[model samples]
Structures are given as C-alpha cells and as structure tokens.
Target: TIFLDEIGELTNSAQVKLLRILETKEFFRVGGTTPLISDFRLIAATNRDLKESVLNGKFRADLYFRIAGTSIYIPPLRERPKDIPVLAYKFMMELAQSKGVSFGGFSDDALSLMMAYHWPGNVRELKNFVEKALLLSEGRVIRARDISSYFEEHSEFGRSLPTKFDSSVPSQLIFDNLQKIWEELKAIKMKLSEIETEKKLSSGSETLNIEETEKKLITSALEKTKGNKVQAAKFLGFSTKTLYRKMKKYGLR
Candidate 1:
C-alpha cells in the first residue's frame, strides 16, 4: 500500500501524472521512464481542499476521482464534543502512567473547560497539551492551571477571561479562520485571473456543473476539516442540505 500523507501537496502536474498511473497501470520516475508498472493500494490524507485546488487548477480533477474510489472523511475533535472528556481522561491517565507518575485525574471544572474549548490542532495538539498537565499537577489532580498556558499561547482555544493578556476564543478563532480563507480565496482568485488570461474563462461566465461543484466542496471541506467535513461545516455554519446542494452542484457526491 502506498500511504500518501498529503497527496494534496502534489502539484497539479503531479496529480495529473498520478491519474495517468492509476488509469493505465503505468508510471515513470521523476526523470526516467521505461513505462513502469506497479501494484499497490493508495491511501492519501490532507487538510487542504483538493477540489477547490482543482477548480483553481491547483489540483487535478481526474486524479481526485480516481483516488476517491472510496473516501472516508474523519471528523475533527471540536465536532465530537462528547468524546472530549473521554479522550482527555484517557490521555491523562495514559500520559501519567507513561511518565511513571501516579495521578487521580483532572478536576471537574478543568475537564469541562477542556471539553468546552475547541481543539483546532486536533488530537496531536490535545496530546501535547495533556503532557504539560502531567508535568505540573499539584495534588495528583490536573487542574486548569496546568493546561491554560496551552490555550493562551495557541490563541485558538479561548484564553483565560478578562485578563490583561487573554484572547477572546470566538474572536481569535474567527480571525484566524477568516485570515486563512481570505488567503486561500486570494490565491484561487489569482489562479482564476491567470486562467482567464490564458483561456479567457470568466468567473461570471463560468458554467460549472453540480458534480464539479460538489467535488470542489469535498476537496475544500476536506482541507478545512483536515479531512473532516462534519467539523468543516460547523466551521462554515451550513446546514446539511445546503452543504449537499453545494456538493451536488459540484458533482462531488
């Protein structure tokens, strides 16, 4: 099996090349080509929207279709609120044990706070933050004090309230999210501009099919959710049907 950690990172040209390989059982090295053949399963992961990339010509369309013979979208931590406490306690216990330190657990208040806050960085971030609590617990009980530093420094999870240096959680997340989206929109717009200059394809006149639109959303949602749509939609605040309409419009179901 070929585990592609971030297939989205492959350039549009590379994606096109990958498509050719998948369809014809043929491939060539970076420079050498004897019409090589290989047998392997492909698994790719990404936190970027491949479909938007495709629309903007940053990713290849045919390649996405081929790779998506079956797709499993993973949900980010923020969407699975119920799982938060469970994960936190489990990680804390395991983390404590791994450190050879005996611990009871986190205080209820701390646990709720952890659960309430959104983990933008996901499991990797959660695991790292828990480690700090393990290192500085006072009474075998991890408290907010042990982990608040994480939220403050990251600026995604809400910082402590009303403090001189604390950040507003909602505002920070919004600002961060908008900044990324604006940047991506700008990049895609630039690409669109270039495409128009090249092919005279006008955005106002672009007649994109529903399937095509869906594909773009799937790719975009995947990127936003770090390959998770459930969270991405929550981030986008769209209803299921609305999102479905987009997918259908893009031909991405």
Candidate 2:
C-alpha cells in the first residue's frame, strides 16, 4: 500500500522489507514469509525534521536510501494561510453533514481569523479545528469564541487544559476587558451599538477607519483564544454574525 504520511516515520523493520522489495520484487510482512511479491510504488510524508533525525539516529539509513528515491516535501500551513478558508469550509461542510447541523458556513470575519492562525500543527490540525468548530458554532456563523476550546485542548498536550468558560468570571467585566483589548490594539474596534447615539468625528476625514477598527477586535479575540476566534466570540457572548457586523462596522475587514 502507498503510504501518505512522512517516510521517516516508517518503522525500521518495514523499511528493511521495503528495501528488499525494491531490490528484488519480494517481501514479507511483520511475520509469515511466503515471499510476498508485487510491483508497487511508495509515498510518505511528515512535518518532522527527518534529516536531523537521521543524524540523531532516529531513522534508518538504508530505508532512507530506499524511499529517498522519490522524496517529496509538503510546505507547512503557515506558508499557505490562503488555503485555510477553503479547507475549513470543506471540513465544516463534512462535519455539518455528519452531525446534521447545517449552519451554512463561516462568516468572512471568522474565516479571516482562521487565515491569520499560524497553524503550527499543520493541515491535520486545521481539520480538527474545523470539526470542533461545528460543536460550538452559534447560529449561521462561527465566531472567534467558538474556536477557543480547540486551542485550549491543543495547548494542553497531555497536561491540564487551560482555564476556559470560567463561569466565575463576571460578564460586564469580560465585555470591558474585551473592549480594552480592542482599544489597546493598533486598529479600530468593530461593532455598532444603535444606542441612539453615534459619535461624530471632529475631523470626519480620517477618523479611525472601519477596517482598521474591526481588525483590532478580531486580533484581540484571536489572541485571547490563542488565535481561535470561535471561542473568543463565544466567551464574549456575541454571535459570529454580530462579531462580523461589528468587524465590518469598525472596518475590521
């Protein structure tokens, strides 16, 4: 069978059999050697530093030589943030169908947060994130807060999960804290409060533009959740649509 994962991760024993097969169209499984013979190709992948692992003796030299014949490296997710939205949408659609929860899709702002993510964990991570997103999505949109749990779970790494949904934390203070975070950023805040009052800019020509304002909010939300806007929005108790509207109002686009 053609392997889709990193070649270096292949077991040393498997490598031995593979090498033998390449040299003499014959091989054996983990056990039972009826001289299984076949003509097949090999493929593997991984994010680990294989060459360094080789020097450190974590990988086999001979096996490396065998698979090295057709090595192909895939770039990490950070270098391709543009692909985040497409992948997230695809995964979300599949997840929704599986769960029978069709909430449409990610709002443009939510997608932006996804794109900004560094994705150190790579595409597999992107898949998990999208699946988990459907779990806490609000209405027709996935907000920054809805994604917080995923990040929290990932950051744990066998250790205790970080504090999330701290019910003891007061609501007003949370909103104020989120607002302070937005105001502290280099951009403007998003959100419209038809509180029967709109502040008129004295200069009107160059008030903090909408895009810049909303960016600050999105950035704050993403940062608070470790680049997970879904959870951030949920924590803030705002629908992803509300967050998006605010983002648009403030020019976070």
Candidate 3:
C-alpha cells in the first residue's frame, strides 16, 4: 500500500503518471523497458477541496475518481475539543522523551484554555505551542500559568475586552453580530456531535461522548481552582449554579 499526503498538490504531469499506474497496475523502471506489474492499494489525503479543484480544472476529474475510493472527513481541532487533551499528552510525551524528561501531562486549567481557544492553525500549531510550553515549564506538569503567556503572545484569547461601549453603533447591529457568532459556535458544536455519533457507529466505541468530555473538563477546572468553585465556574464561562449542577451530575467533589 502507498500513502500520498497532500495529493491535491500533485502537478498535471505527476497526476498523469499516477493515474496510469493506478489504471494499469504496472509501471516501468526509470531506465528499464520491462513493464513491472504489482498490486497495491492507494490512499490519498489532501487538505484542499478536491471536488472544487476538479470543478475549477485544477485537478483531473478522471484521476480524482480513480483515487477516491473512500473518503473520511476529520473535523478540525477546535471542533473536536475533547481530543485536545489526548493529543496534547501524545505530543508532550514524545517531546519529553527527546528531552530526557518526565511527562507530567497538562493541568486542568491549561487543558481548559486549550479546548476553549479556536486553533486557527490546527494541530500543527497546537504541537508547536505544546513544545514551547514544555520547554518553558519549570516542572513536570504544564500548568495554566506556564503556557498562558505563550497563548497571549500568539493569540487574542486573553486580550482585554472593550472598556467602553460604542454608543454610535446601533444596538440592533451589535445584537446581530452577537447572534452570528452564536450561530457559528452552534454549528461547530453540531459538527462535533455528528462526528461523535459517526465514530461510535463505525468503531463501536464510546470514546467521544461530549457529556463525558464535559464532565472531565469540569473536574479539571475545579482541580485547577483549588476548590474555589466560584473561580472555576467563572473561568469555565459557566454560571455558579450550572457548575454546581454539573458537579452533582458527574459526582464530582
């Protein structure tokens, strides 16, 4: 089997050669005349929208069909916030091994901040940020304090809110802007829910339960705040009452 990452970037000439190989299941050596026949499976991945590329004449329609045997859509990191901790740990451990250090994992508040942020650069950005955090960390565990500066430096997450409301701007316009942001958040959440359902059906594993993930987040927040439920709830963007209710539901202390 052969795996081609970013196959959408293939040039026209390269695509022609690949298509021929797929069609005939044979190819000649660089300088040999004998045709070499071998059976192999092809798996191609691309971040680009291949269908749109095909319509725009950027990718060949016949080549697209030949390689597109099965397609799986993996949502971006921000949409699947539950996967953040897992991937963070994976990256942290790998980095720690290379540095000859122990992997202490991420503190709850740190993980919470990560889950809340919209990763514009996706997993690669997350990995790079994790490396920075690990390097600057004074201890084994990566606490919120350890990486908070990096987040602020690289993103607008912890930036100050507007001190004064703009009276000149119409209230309705402000409301409409808020509504659009809310709708976008809702859409992302819906996509995550759909992906969770698909994962359960295909893998027969209940690994992506949003409720379970929420429970873990709440537990982490509480731990980070050191039993200050009010602060934890505030940090989590939840009302104290809601936080209490979730703690009760999850049998959290």
Tens-place lDDT per residue, model 3, 11-60, is 99999999999999999999999999989998888878999999999999
After superposition, the stretches of candidate 1 with alpha carbons farther than 4 Å from their true spots are 26-36, 93-103, 156-253
The clash number for model 3 is 0
**Model 1: what TM-score?**
0.52
> Which prediction has more favorable lDDT, 2 or 3?
3
Q: In model 1, how many backbone clashes occur?
A: 16
Query: How should the candidates be ordered by TM-score, best one leading?
Result: 3, 2, 1
TM-score of 3: 0.57
Error of 1 at 84 (Å): 1.6
Instruction: List model 1 lDDT by residue over 208-235, tens digit each.
Output: 2323323443566557568565775554
Worst 10 residues of 1 by lDDT: 205-214
Off by over 4 Å in 3: 31-33, 156-253
